[model samples]
Target chain A: MSTRFRPTTLTGHELELREQVRRFVAEEFPAGEYLPGLGINAEASPEFSRKLARQGWLGMVVPAEYGGPGRTAVERFVVVEELLVAGAPISAHWVGDRQTAPALLKFGSEEQKRRFLPAIIGGEAWFCLGMSEPGSGSDLASVRTSAVRTDGGWVLNGQKIWTSGAHYADFVVTLCRTAPLDGVKHAGLSQLIVDLRSPGIEVRPIMMLNGFHHFNEVFFTDVFVPDEMVLGAVGDGWHQVTSELAYERSGPDRFLTSFPLLRIFLALRARRAVGAEAEHRIGRLVARYWVLRQMSLSVARSLDAGEVPAVEAALVKDMGTTFEQQVVDVVRELADAEQRPGGDLFDRLLAEATITTPTFTLRGGTNEVLRQVAAKSLLRGAGRAA
Target chain B: MSEEIELLEQTLDALFARHCGPAERTAAAQGLLPERLWARLVETGLTDLGAPDSGAGLPELVAVAMAVGRAAAPVPLAEASGLASWLLGATGLDPADGLLGCATTHPDDDLRLVGGEPAAPVVRGVLTRVPWGAAAGHVVALARSDRGPVVVLLPAATQVERGANLADEPRDTLRYADVTAVAAAPAPVDAAAVLRRGALLRAAATAGAAGRVLELALAYAGAREQFGRPIATFQAVQHHLVVMAEEVAAVDLAVRVAALAGPDTEALAVAAAKVAAGTAAAEVTRRGHQVFGAIGATIEHPLHHYSKRLWSWQDEFGTDRQWSGVIGRAAVGAGADALWPTVSAPLDPAPEAALR
Candidate 1:
């Protein structure tokens, strides 16, 4: 309700950590040598993931007892922002380090944390969210992925569409309908950690707009999940999943997708005398990016300070995603990729961005829905301050 | 916020609540300068905070300007103390002249410098769009001379052509014809520096006004009912409020960070903030009008005071194209290698702002 985003500056230590990531990028993926990516939907390199984890940059928020270094959210933000701006291939460990480890720390049992957190921080484990089924994308409470109680575990049966990297994932923290629909739509649901290697599970590939296999139709049938695999409590799945929204919705990933392309555009512009249009384009894009980083970092710092910035996070995510897509449009318009069929990295990234931008808004939450999410929260907190 | 700023804000809030309203704005628009409200605010000595000897800097001026913008109080709080005193100091003007005001020179002003005696230099030009020119005790402007830029300070008794912006704020013009200058000298600062400072002040003000507009929209939507419920409950209205909130947050962050950045990038930072504020002024006012509907569009409502001020201030310092173009050129000049470093440049937090 308060439209204030408390400004956050990186501490000296956090800035040092940022330099470390920059040094790593310089060593591993030097400029003009690596293929830049669009946001987190870049190349999936397990080798790169392991290298980052060895640097203690993975599962940053996971407490030390569970193998992570227990760094502050802002520190993780510092590292991830550098990697994202550099367009590092973080896809393989992106979901696990970003979502799964936090889920384990918050809701995973001691046994589950010991088993999963170590693998996650080591970058040996990968995760795919099972909240979205064929019928439940934004309306996650309507998930039809049912789980029946068995002797020692639950039997899962349903299909999750648009599950990014399910084929590459080692486990899935799935949203399952554990009980009958007893009048209330949000009740009777539970989160079950299902192993992708379990029997009666199929990770069928779904080609994306960019002709990449980033998504999958993950079908589950009679998949047995032990009682220990249950996340939180039955009928608490809705709350548990919604709790992840802040972390998932607002992060460096929301805005840094097309940054590398902007870098490329700048590089090219430097070689020539850019006209007024290009200058305005580059200037406005950089302006938006700068403010978006501040906004995103504010949310991260607020989370670190134990604030539930649901509205703030939604504001950042929605605005950040839209700004990123606009980044693509600016670069494309300025680059004139249509005429330069086989141009340089600028053209190539522009092609990828033009195609992949639709997914940028689609991936976490569509712009339209996120706007409403933020608006509803705003209205709810009406008259708090004038 | 630091205690000083917090107290200043609280004081301003209470003062505005008590004295600044429809009557004050109406009186000022009709040429009275809102004497009672001005008297109350001046009692706080905020304008003196901008005096050169006071050591108050951009942060202070920005704070007061934003607050003035929010209250829609028609006063020379920022201009008289901030820009006027900050720039005219090297002109050897006596500080005893009281709350000096500065005006930006325009090409249309056709400013010229004919030769004059060393004791009394003459400025021959028409200073255009001088904010609070008619009300300012002493008006100062910058003109081009053979040596370099010249700072010309005009006494309050100088002749003036009164004008007004859309919000009905005074923007009087002053004409000179080999006129004796109260004080004039080779400028200690360039036109670019003056424009940058002015743009930043305007941006801060625009940010403040936009914030108030959002609050008003939110307050209105929460109270106004249609279709059996508060319009805020309607998804359509909520959408407008959310988008306005985004613009307000973005603009506010831009202005604050620009104010925080070190001298190295202050120009680009100010330019970027001005550009963002310009864009926000449009977006917030448009979405704001939609949320308020007819009531917001009325002359009786206070919304117009902020919206009209936003509209006027946005074009004052520099248009969006002018500022954004400067930013664009800077980025290209720095080259691609410095792109991220430039965009993600860390703020060199000012001492007073260290509390943040």
Candidate 2:
């Protein structure tokens, strides 16, 4: 049997990058500055994102010629981890930096790259995904958003639900069916770089459980996306979107959403002499977190080497989001702090985490869907070997 | 792996395949050691691969332990090669040509040194659940001396009452009234350090067994039919198999980190590895049995071999709960501000100074 799953240790450079990111977060986005458990969709300030871009953090994996720092995926992972742990508001530039830039680099035309890459790297543009429609949550292949071919462009008409940050995004990389659905369900679909400010488009707020307006229902009625704005080839939306899921699924964001609460709990627990039970509970959580981090880092390394690692990415997401929710469960069980909505930091963070915990396994492809994806791939591989 | 280690692994694999087959394992499980296989392993220098002079490190020993685990070979690879040889070489004893074992299982075993009167010390008290205590040529154990905790090597001629763990390996109880030591020296590490080493070895073995069980479950799911279709086609069985795979993968990475960790981080790394591996062993074995249904529970099926060993090994060094306590205490002690840094610090490979 091939030893494909051998463990990996970080290099000196990756360690250095991690330390640098940690120091940056501490100095710039200190613990008390922001509320905890804001989730990854917390509204971020453009100024903060620009500051990160100045530090050569944003667009880390994009090539230098495209106005990026040209770092490896592991380096990007270090930055993302530190930001998440610090509870930094990264939503402003998250989608554009994390997935949009990479997608543009891979499948975008030269004009599209020249037009969008620099703005994304400069933290001036925010991108929200337009994949999930009103009727197509996990069944993304059934997306009914149509893009009828016009003289100079495609007229988009459909409704996209759960579009995170659509209100603040400058553009949405909308997935639409461009041709008749007479062939394979995945074919004849295309990705269009639809400008969010175009005519005949409306963004309606969908408040979260915490009364946060981070999610939206975006409607596109005859929104004209020019041919120059198309991402990749027409009729290749399925492949392009699936390729981007690796980035969406294998990030530190999936697991670090509730990390701020954990940090507060640990700090509070340290002041008092908690008994062995608390210690054991805290320790198990930390150990599990460490394992998850290592596993996520391994996926990053694979991505750095330009391997898709779709199954591995799905595995990380499935395990990671569950661990993220577990962090909330553990803190709630152990913390003696009050659970009032507007009490001390511990209570407030605990409340936020309680509200946000349910979404951890729901977003970025529900855990059930991801498990099926991973299972099929793994069984197929095993069957071939057998 | 280095060229030499890879060659050694290939050699060991070939050796196990030739001599340590199902019949041999069954015999070993029936209260008998495969003497010929053990002799071959020792003579081939595979058992002493962890000696300082052997130019192999813990990573190499981990590889050997994993191989030993995959075959369920009834040898003291972990105890002898991993812990004993390192201890012997550290305390200035000859590590050559001895099947060594250690008695450091329980914390309350009151083994102490007495009466050598300016010469070597004599060991007393009882050490329970000592791995390979009856079969080993010598046993290295921690005993309280007038100075402090000293390590004493006792010959296997001491009185030993044979015991067995879940997997039927020799976990004997040794009673030493006045067993004279062949060699006595200061312990290179504390009892906790010794336990961590043993835990690391067991984690590696567990990972190997977990990997094997995952392969078994996968193959079985593909073949077994339910409702006139392969059970593997069902989402439920596939989910179980994937979870098993995830556990195996986590254990594999955790073991590597623990094995290669520096002295400063070794304790935390090992504790994490043990917890993850122990937990994984339980889940993987349970799911493996679930996938195989009743056949996996029967002794006739080979699946029970790996699953039983996993069940026994998870509790041998330290259960998940026990190690979780160790890790939890350490993290809480470090406090919130320092926890991330403490866990994410780059590993130092420097050997630790002798434990105080």
Candidate 3:
């Protein structure tokens, strides 16, 4: 294998995409227009979501065959990372554009692809994942959401908690236990695309610590789905869900969530003369962040190559999240020592980041689960089958 | 660019495991390990590793330093053989196999060249707590002067007396006190750069030790049952273990990148890597001890051996606070623009640097 890496820096195409995305964010949903409040749906709004669609930035990852740019994962990473770092009001279309679109393009039937992919690319459609029920959070194998065979499709009857954007999502990709495969608890599950407007389905918003309705407890009461809505073959839900997770976990989003605050921290730190000690602290932080970004991008390249780098993704997420929290901690300490403005943008950004950071280790997968996964992969070579 | 160095890493790993086990390390601490083992290391071409045309070079030096650190070998392999050999090589001196030490700070002038005392002295005053001093055949001291930092070689046999460094290592305090020594030919090597390299290699050793501690803690966590199941299954201990793993991963990456950084950026990388690895070492060792409960602190337990080494090595080349201050000064002086241009610079290399 060649030791030469694809340049450690971004190239022209990537830079162009970033600048375009940055301009779209600035012009369409400037911070003044929709500065996220400390609530559940801090940055989610329909108008803001559609604005992205109209500008053709939403389908940056969607293939041209699906009315999208059909760009490389690197390009997608470049754009979304910039948007996320800018703290754009992007929650409304984030999942749909980021992972769901890619997953559908990979696993969706041609018809399913034709139906949802274009809308997703056009930014007119939105999505949420129905993988985690209350009892089965990161332990997705234990999902009890059942889907019984019906005349048209499958009748889904189970509940999914922490379904982000379900309140506004047009469709949800639901994972259900279709048949009782006896060998392992994971083999029996299957994925079905569910329409949010279908009868017997309930979407009740759950107020998070941030006090936003960004996520909802989506209940399925014998919810009917057309036969065409079944994603892939029966008993493939585990495989599909794992694929989705690899996408969700590996991107720049894992590390760049605190980027807005990073900018603010840099600006504020520069205003005062940082002594040797503080400079060292900040430099070390930046160095760590840079290395983590490189590692995360390596994983992204792996994903683009169609490899399931589950363990690598887990490692990145674990390291990236903790480092982000560390950055928050360091910045807070620096802020206190410097006695900088408490009400300034930097302070607000820091506070906002702090509130969101707890989820860093908990969200995608808890740190404990991630470590177990990491050890098994390194020691036992887990995920070899997939 | 350096495949030989990469291969040398495998060789050092094999050597360390063969010669520096717990018992051998303990024996070395007591000066009871067979003299032949050290002789064999020298005979195996490990001692002359940092010497140019000695078959092993910069890469081998790095690998050996890390390997010895990992083994927690009580020998001053890094200082005696690694740093001393490096400083000697820099001055175009033949660094023979045996004990050697290097000091960045030394006081003395106009004392030594050939016989009793020549026009200029090599090293003066004394460098206290010089690692590997007790056993080194020679100690190389670099004194900052108006010209630059002049490299001076002080043989352990003639001028230096030994002082205990406390741990089992061969550290010693030396008294140069107007001692006479040869000027030794000046070779083109930056003392600061060599020191930074040594610091980075030291951090690598600390990282290896920290990784072992984490592995031990993880294994213990797996089997040491608490209320019902193994404590590894417990969220609290598991979380801490994961945190340790994260630190290990971070330091591991930092060290590797710093190792590969170019001359211009090497110092910065070394400073950053030291801060990370040093901080990780202190924290991970403490947590590893915590997981072992009271047993880890007892002298009977081998865990202390690794932890003590970690504590000592973190303060050897550079402390966490010291490195942090270095980084902080650079960041502040560079301002926000150059502070982290690799990350913050508009995704494009600054055009001016491109022209070059």
iRMSD values, candidates in order: 2.2, 5.5, 6.8
**Full ranking by lDDT:** 2, 1, 3
Q: Residue by residue across A1-386, what tens digits does model 3's lDDT show?
A: 00111113355666777778767766754543333332222477767767767777776767777678777776777766666655667787877887778778878899988898888877688888887889998798998999899897888998999888898889998988999758799798988889999999999998877565667899999999988998887898787777767677767777766655655666665653466656667777766766676566656666666677676677678877777788878777777654333667666667677777787778766877877766544433212211
User: lDDT of each model, Cα atoms only?
Assistant: 0.80, 0.81, 0.67
Q: Write the per-residue lDDT of candidate 1 for residues B68-161, one digit (tens) a residue.
A: 7888778777676567777765555665345456786544565667877543577787888788777777777887788888877666636788
**lDDT score at residue B336, model 2, on the 0-100 scale:** 80
Single out the weakest 10-residue window by summed lDDT for candidate 3 chain A.
Answer: A1-10
- Candidate 2 per-residue lDDT over residues A1-386, each given as its tens digit: 21233345567777778878878887886666557435585666788899998888888888878777888887888888888877888889988988899999999999988889889888889999998987899999899999998999898999999998999899998888999898689999999998999999999999998988889999998888898998999999999999987788878887778888888877655553278888778878878877777777777877777788787778778888888888888888787655788877778788888887888899877888788888788778888988
On DockQ, the stronger of 1 and 3 is: 1
* Candidate 2 residue spans exceeding 4 A from truth: A1-6, A37-39, A269-273, A336-338, B1-7, B96-98, B117-119, B349-356
Candidate 1 Cα outliers beyond 4 Å, as residue runs: A269-273, A337-343, B52-55, B88-93, B96-99, B105-120, B145-147, B150-152, B184-188, B349-356
TM-score for chain B of all predictions: 0.92, 0.93, 0.84
Writing each residue's lDDT as its tens digit, candidate 1 over A231-343 gives: 88877898888888889988999999989988877776454338987777777887788888888888887888788888888888888888889988877777663635356
TM-score leader = 2
Native A-B contacts reproduced, model 3: 0.30
Q: Give fnat of each prediction, in order.
A: 0.64, 0.58, 0.30
DockQ of 1: 0.59
